[model samples]
Target: MLKDFKAFIMRGNVVDMAVGVVIGASFGGIVKSLVDDVLMPPIGLLLGRVDFSNLYLILREGTAPGPYAALAEAKKAGAVTLNLGLFANTVINFIIVALAIFLVVRAVNRLQAMQKSKEPEAAPSTRECPFCASTISIKAVRCPQCTSALAE
Candidate 1:
C-alpha cells in the first residue's frame, strides 16, 4: 500500500497537476490585483472617480448610521449590504483568467498539431513484386499476380 501510494504521487500527471495548481493560485492573485488595483482605478477615474470597490447597496443600516463612506466602513459597522463593485471586479478577473487559459490551450493544441505533422509516417506495409510489378504484402513468399516463385 505504501509503495502504491508513492507510485501514484510520483506519476507524471499528478506532478504536473500539482504544479499547475500552484501556478493557477499565483495567477489568481495576480489577476485579482490587476482588477482591483490597476484596472478599476483607471476605470473609476474615467467614470468620474467612482470607486468600484466601495459600490454597494445597504439592505440594513449598521450600528453607526445610514450613510457609509466605503464598503469597509459599512462592514465595520455590521451593515447588511450587497457588494456590487467587488462582484464586478471578480467577474472581470474571471474573464481575464478564462481568456488567458483559452489562449494557452489553443496555442498548445496548435503546437501539438504542428509536431504531429512533422513526425514521419509509419513505414509502408506492402511492397511491389519484382516479377509481376504488382503490389503485395511484404511477407509474401510468392507472387500472387503472376504466380511466380519469390526468393527468400
Candidate 2:
C-alpha cells in the first residue's frame, strides 16, 4: 500500500498538478494586488475619489449610530453591513486571472497544433499477398501466411 501510494504521488500528472497549484496561488495573489492596489485606485480617482471598498449598506445599527464613513469603521462599531465594493474587487480579480489562464491555454494549444502539423508522415511499405490476401512487406520473397512464392 505504501509503495502504491508513493507511485501515485510520484506520477507525472500528480507532480504537474502540485506545481500548477503553487503557481496558481502565486498568480492569484498578484491579480488580487493588481485589482485592489492598481486598478481600483485609478477607477476611484476617476469617479471623484469614491472608494469602492468603503461602499456598503448597513443592515443593523451598531453601538456607533448612523453615518459611518468607512467599512472598517462600521466593522469596528459592530455594524452588520453588505460589502458591495469588496465583492466588485473580487469579481475583477477573478476576471483577470481567468483571462490570463485562457490566454496561456490558447497559446499552448496553438503550439501543440503547429508541432503536429509539422511532423512528416510515414509512407506505407506493405502490400496484400496474392494468395492469402495478407499484408506483407514489398521486399518479401514469400508470403508468411500461405508460404506462397511471389513474382520478382
Candidate 3:
C-alpha cells in the first residue's frame, strides 16, 4: 500500500498537475496585481479620476457620521458596505488571466498544426506496366501478367 501510494504520487500526471496548480496560483496573483496596480489606475484616471477601489455602497452608517473616507475605515467603524471597486478589479484580473491563457493555448495549437503539416507523407510503391497497363510493384523483376523482363 505504501509503494502504491508512492507510485501514485510520483506519476507524471500527478506531478504535472501539482506544478500547474502552483504556477496557476502564482500567475493569478500576478494578474491581480496587473489589474490593480497597472491597468485600473490609468483607466480610472481616464474616466474622470474615479477610483474603482473606492467605489462602494454604504449599507449602514458608521458610528461617527455620514460618509466614511475609505472602505477600511468604514469596515473598522462597523459599517456594512458593498465593495464594488474591489469586485471590479477582481473581474478585470480574471479577464486578463483568461486572455493570456487563451493566447498560450492558441500558440500551442498553431505549433502543433505546423508540426503536423511538416510530416513526410508515405509515397506509392506500385506503378502501372506500360505493356499491360497492370499495376506492378516497383521491386518486381518481371511482369507477372505479360512475362516481360522489367528494367531495373
- Kindly list the per-residue Cα lDDT of model 1 for residues 1-152, writing each as its tens digit: 99999999999999999999999999999999999999999999999999999999999988999799889999999999999999999999999999999999999999999999999999888989988799998888888899888877
Q: Rate the local accuracy (lDDT) of all candidates.
A: 0.95, 0.94, 0.91
Error of 1 at 104 (Å): 0.5
Candidate 1: lDDT of 42?
Answer: 94
TM-score to native of every candidate shown? 0.83, 0.82, 0.74
The true-versus-predicted C-alpha distance at residue 40 of model 1, in Å, is 0.7
The TM-score obtained by model 2 is 0.82
Ranking by lDDT: 1, 2, 3
Candidate 1: residue 81 Cα off by (Å): 0.7
Candidate 2 residue 63 Cα shift, in angstroms, is 3.4
How many angstroms is residue 76 displaced in model 3 relative to the true structure, after the best TM-score fit?
1.0
Of the candidates shown, which would achieve the greatest TM-score relative to the real structure?
1
RMSD of each: 4.0, 2.6, 5.1
Model 1 TM-score (2 dp)? 0.83
Clashes of each: 0, 0, 0
The count of residue-pair clashes in candidate 3 stands at 0
Q: Which stretch of 10 consecutive residues in model 1 shows the poorest summed lDDT?
A: 143-152
- lDDT assessment of candidate 1: 0.95
Which structure among the candidates has the greatest lDDT? 1
